[model samples]
Target: MMAYYARRKLPTSCLCRVSELRRQFTSASPLFFQGTSSVLSNRVPSSAPEGTRLTGCNVFKNKDEPLALADEEYPDWLWEILDPEAQQKKLDADPERKAKREWRARMRRKIKTDNFLKTMS
Candidate 1:
């Protein structure tokens, strides 16, 4: 566990969060680096499109899904797993977005501390 984070020297808070994330995904755990490769290999589209499909294009095959997850185009499943503060910071780096992310981070801290106080009481 020490070796895992030693490569990057991430802080203890980040390490605790990563451990929590590992516990969260324990049911369907896959190697952190190899992400979704096995899933992609086993995917089979239900039916072929009517017109000719282009080859060597990087576009997403699922027309039903949006092209990007950022810019508020994320799916519900993604939103569930995402850290809202991190997502906001990554998707929009403007001063307004920074303010919003900071507020959200503070709110989360407050909620967690409040819950801890409740448990203690």
Candidate 2:
């Protein structure tokens, strides 16, 4: 880990907070370098985005291109480590999306009928 940071020349302070990290947690975890005095606090990699490890050309700069989660992007690690029970609650509490889906389907049918009538007239 130190080797990677040294290669990148990042300091130990970069692992602090968002306002602090404003550009951290990119390619690797900052915790890995926190222990060693060899920590490097260099800015985020130039190859990556301003606040991320992925750069503009290499990454999606707009909604058309979304960043894929390293994991399920469901239960964050902090949630699992701090409150794992919350994960279970989410699965158990999927409330009924069926109602909303049905409403949307009905609205679509109405729209199609209205459009057809206007075309016929």
Candidate 3:
């Protein structure tokens, strides 16, 4: 069965022809197979001058800098959304959420106890 499949000629498509042409062109070109010495030469200098840094984004603020805009410029809800402590405080203040949190904790403890008992048995 392996020999029968191996002897069979596979049908070639336009994609196969284009890929074969691309392979031939690339293999013949000296630029395509050039050494890493060219790449090393193209690299930026190790010691870049101070104050000019490459940032991934346009906002070039340091990591230590606060992300919040002025309170007047940003909406109150935006600040509330950004602050995890405020969100947690809000959740704690809500009676329904507090009950749900307690219920989840109880369920998790019950599940852990049940699994422990099963393993012991």
Candidate 4:
């Protein structure tokens, strides 16, 4: 006797559609509703607990003064890698910067970029 095979039908609804339906039905009541902030306040506590220090060193440790040479100092920072390229491209692409081409403007941009680069590391 020859064996016969049958293929199962694919689901009509996607995972997201099923999830949406489930969410709608489950949260139909006021207690479970997402928009009812007062009812849900007891279940969810906002903000970190007291005496919780933020991760990483504080940038304002040296008052409000910026670092003199951020690029030279912190070359490996994430902001340094991403920010400088974008800022350089913006400065290069701007028609006003090109037209002015003043040393002061270029210096200002460079300083700002370097200061940003130094801040994250």
Candidate 5:
């Protein structure tokens, strides 16, 4: 019980100990009783509701910035731009990506040739 008080801080007028809240946070349920049964439970804090830090947390709460968030039409989310069939077509179009294919072939052949061999060795 003392350990729980250490982990949880609830904003309530009652003289509830920290341990009670800490026990609630660790509960597996998404919902829990916050205040004393008499005080009535309401309101979740706006800051870090996920119970984690906002910056450098690695958990991407906002999917926009990483995925073209600046533009609504080209948002970084793949689902926003292409449906399943379109994604498949994009994959199928790889063979027609001539410039890249030619570049790769050129690179492979050039690896054993003079221009690359002299520079590498």
Candidate 6:
């Protein structure tokens, strides 16, 4: 491990010295303000206007409701994709899905029969 690190010419001792210097600088630095005399301490409370709703944090929007679009405007295929019943029908119509379902049912029945036979024996 030492030979591999030596071959790569990595300064392991310099890394420890750099970390110590960073720790000392961070501990001594007065960059962060802690007392109430700081500029951030003079923050004003947010208030929403009459009839408008506050949907999110610090967000205010008009009281106007969204207009509903006509269902006829959207494509038939889009509605078929969105509808749960239509999606189920589409999956049920697939030959590969039908085969897998039938195989699963047979395996479940076989498992139950084997368990019953083992219990009887």
TM-score comparison, 2 vs 5, better candidate: 2
Please give, for residues 13-85, the per-residue lDDT of candidate 5 as tens digits: 2124233434434442333222222112332222223323323222245542221122223323322121233
- Least accurate 10 contiguous residues by lDDT in model 1: 39-48
**Candidates, ranked, TM-score:** 3, 6, 1, 2, 5, 4
Which stretches of candidate 3 lie above 4 Å from their native place?
Answer: 1-84
lDDT over C-alpha atoms for residue 87 of model 3: 60
Compute each candidate's TM-score over C-alphas.
Answer: 0.27, 0.27, 0.33, 0.19, 0.20, 0.29
Backbone collision count in every prediction?
0, 7, 0, 0, 4, 0
Q: Which scores better on lDDT, 1 or 5?
A: 1
Best by TM-score: 3
Query: Please, what are the lDDT tens digits per residue for candidate 6 over residues 51-106?
Result: 44323222125534333334444344532332344456677889899789889999
- Candidate 4: the clashing residue pairs are none
RMSD of 2: 17.9
Model 4 lDDT tens row, 58-84: 345554433233222333322222233
Model 2, 17-121: lDDT tens digits are: 322333333334544233222122321232223334322223223534233343323333322322224344544466465456668899999999999999999
lDDT for model 1, please.
0.46
lDDT-better candidate, 3 vs 5: 3
Q: Which stretches of candidate 4 lie over 4 Å from their true place?
A: 1-52, 55-82, 98-101, 105-121
Any residue pairs clashing in model 5, and if so which? 5-18, 5-19, 67-76, 68-76
Better candidate by lDDT, 3 or 4? 3
Clashing residue pairs in candidate 6 (N, C-alpha, C atoms within 3 angstroms) = none
Go through the candidates in order and give each one's C-alpha lDDT: 0.46, 0.41, 0.46, 0.41, 0.38, 0.47
- Residue 37's lDDT in candidate 4: 40
User: 33-112, model 3: which lDDT tens digit per residue?
Assistant: 23334323332222213443333222333554223233244443432332344467778789899899989999999999
Tens digits of lDDT, candidate 1, 51-111:
4342322234554422222323324333224333334545575887778878999999999
